[model samples]
Target: MSTALVLIMTPGLAFFYGGMVNKKNVISTMLQSIVCMVIITVLWGIFGFSLAFGESFHGFIGNPATYFMMKGMLGNATWKAAPTIPLLLFAMYQLKFAIITPALITGAFAERIRFNSYIIFLVLFSIFIFSPLAHCTWHPDGILAKLGVLDFAGGTVVHMSAGWAALASALYLKRRNEANHSPARITYVMIGTGLLWFGWFGFNAGSAFGANALAVTALATSTTASAAGGITWIFFDMLRGRKPSAMGTCIGAVVGLVAITPAAGFVTVPHSLAIGIISAVVSNLVVEWRTRTTIDDTLDVFPCHGVGGMVGMLLTGVFANQHVNAGNTTGNGLFFGETHLFLVQLLAMVGVSVFAFFGSLLLLKITDMISPLRVSAEDEELGLDISQHGEKL
Candidate 1:
């Protein structure tokens, strides 16, 4: 059920993103997300899962040969961390994550990218960026894990990396021909937000790997953080003399979800509330700041996902408690007067930000060379839905 929940988020993402694009480009934008479900699944079964969760190689990545072609996944096989479940179940659950990370970046390049080129970049990102990060952060023998960096879910592996890659994509792709357009469908955004919020319980709680107290704690934290985030966003807007909007509410809730992801299983509900509030404000400010710049991140992916992930990771180091989960061997957060965990989390954030940002820029360059990354001016004027897919809203 958890696996199914996570899988639904990709389609939810499609709707979320599709609703935000120009009406003429809505189909193309949504398809960019939907395609990942097919592409990443095939890759994961073949070797993508191995590269992320197989035997660690010098703490960098998993050896692709270790779980090649799902060779060793028998009925009794189990991942070390998730002993109660079959290895196949864990693999499938993780696969949902791989599908969405690339899909998330679609928002940045929405309506402007060539579908074939985007697919190329997605494959490259899944292998080079997403897989290594997942290995380093999650695998017991991987570098960040060994360094005692704690990511209950995928704050780093999913949000941070996707966020950075989104920035790189926006920069490389440059501005869309018509960058200013009203949303295609506000109702779709609301529906997508509902699905994402509902599915997120499984995304966070299921990380406990079993039906346990930790899972319950994670579920509660996720709920409060998201609620706090949604309300805070609208409140902030009203304070600035802007009307509270459904769009603001939806974006705020999602930001809260992203912010609480890392700390959900490691922090108290109150701290989760703090994380949600802090992240929503920070992301809201960043989104405003982004509009002042020449950077054309169409949907503010960097502001919401990237900055939200960073804030969550840092706060995890600030508020994490061993009493919350005996799994935090790195010691308590800075709020408890322990400096080691916070410093370690800080270092990991810097390293990951640099790696994800620069690595993605290189992949975009390569992908562009293989196939033109952007559509021609004629095609752009026609809208992606009609030009790219020969369809329209």
Candidate 2:
């Protein structure tokens, strides 16, 4: 059951992200999420697992000494936290995460990239960038984790890093396609929003590693925050004498979910609500502000996910109560008057963002040296759903 739940979570993200894109590109976008999951799973077993979970090296990346399948891993317990479950199970859970990290970047380059090239980029980026990152932030002896960066889940590892990388890819894809500039399809966006909310229960609460108090509390807080965020966006829309559109409500829900991810294990229901509302307003403002600039963040992944992740991480520091999570080393969080924790959270966020952005950029440039990253302008105009995959919308 533990093994099944972890692997399934990434595909759940597929429904969430696929539905948000234009109807024409639904399969194309979802394909990125799905394919990433599978490819990462294979890579994880072969080399990624060793590179990340093997012996610690200089507090940066792990060693590749544990190479090959079923060798060092057979029947032996080579893990921490949960030993009763097979080491393979724990490795798969982490593998699902590695797969999705770069898959999430696909959203940024949605309509323009060559499918074959993206497949290549996915494999390389997961190996070069994500494996090291997961090692740095997740392993028991990881530098950031050792320094007390409280991810709880993957606010930094998944959202912020993907967001930064997504932005870079979006820019690198070179603003192709007239179709993307068209008004987004709200109906499709709403469907994506619903799936994201449903899957997040597993995404956040499941991080507890069991069905227990902290898990239950996280589920409730995640649920409440999402609801309040949707309602808050509605309220904000009403204040302007306009009815809230489906897109607005969904973005609100997404922001809330993103904000709650980091703080889920630490804060109470009320804090989740506050963080949700604040996140909706802040992300809304960010989207509006970003549009005025030259950065063509195709799906606004950075503002909603990246910005929301940052908000949630900082809010975790602010609202975190060690009473809730015994693992939280900082006994008193920001709300309890320990302000330095917030700074630490920001520092951690910045570190991950910088690493993911540059690391992914280097990977893409290497891929580009071998093959063009984006589809031709003519193919993009014709639409990725049909051009890259050879399928109709």
- Give the number of the best model, judged by TM-score: 1
What local lDDT score does residue 356 receive in model 2, on the 0 to 100 scale?
Answer: 82
Quote the positional error of residue 32 for candidate 1 in Å. Answer: 0.9
Candidate 1 — which pairs collide? none
Candidate 2: tens digits of C-alpha lDDT, residues 175-228: 655634443355556666766677677678877777789889888999998988
Model 1 lDDT tens row, 206-324:
89988999999999999999999999999999999999999999999999999999999999999999999999999999999999999999999999999999999999999999999
For model 2, the superposed segments whose C-alpha errors exceed 4 Å read: 1-9, 74-78, 179-188, 240-242
Per-prediction TM-score to the true structure, in the order listed: 0.99, 0.92
How much lDDT does each candidate structure score? 0.94, 0.77
Q: In model 2, how large is the Cα lDDT of residue 243?
A: 86
Superposed model 1: Cα runs more than 4 Å off: none
Name the best candidate (by lDDT): 1
Clashing pairs in 2: none
Model 1 clash number: 0
How much is the lDDT of residue 179 in candidate 1? 89
Each candidate: RMSD:
0.6, 2.3
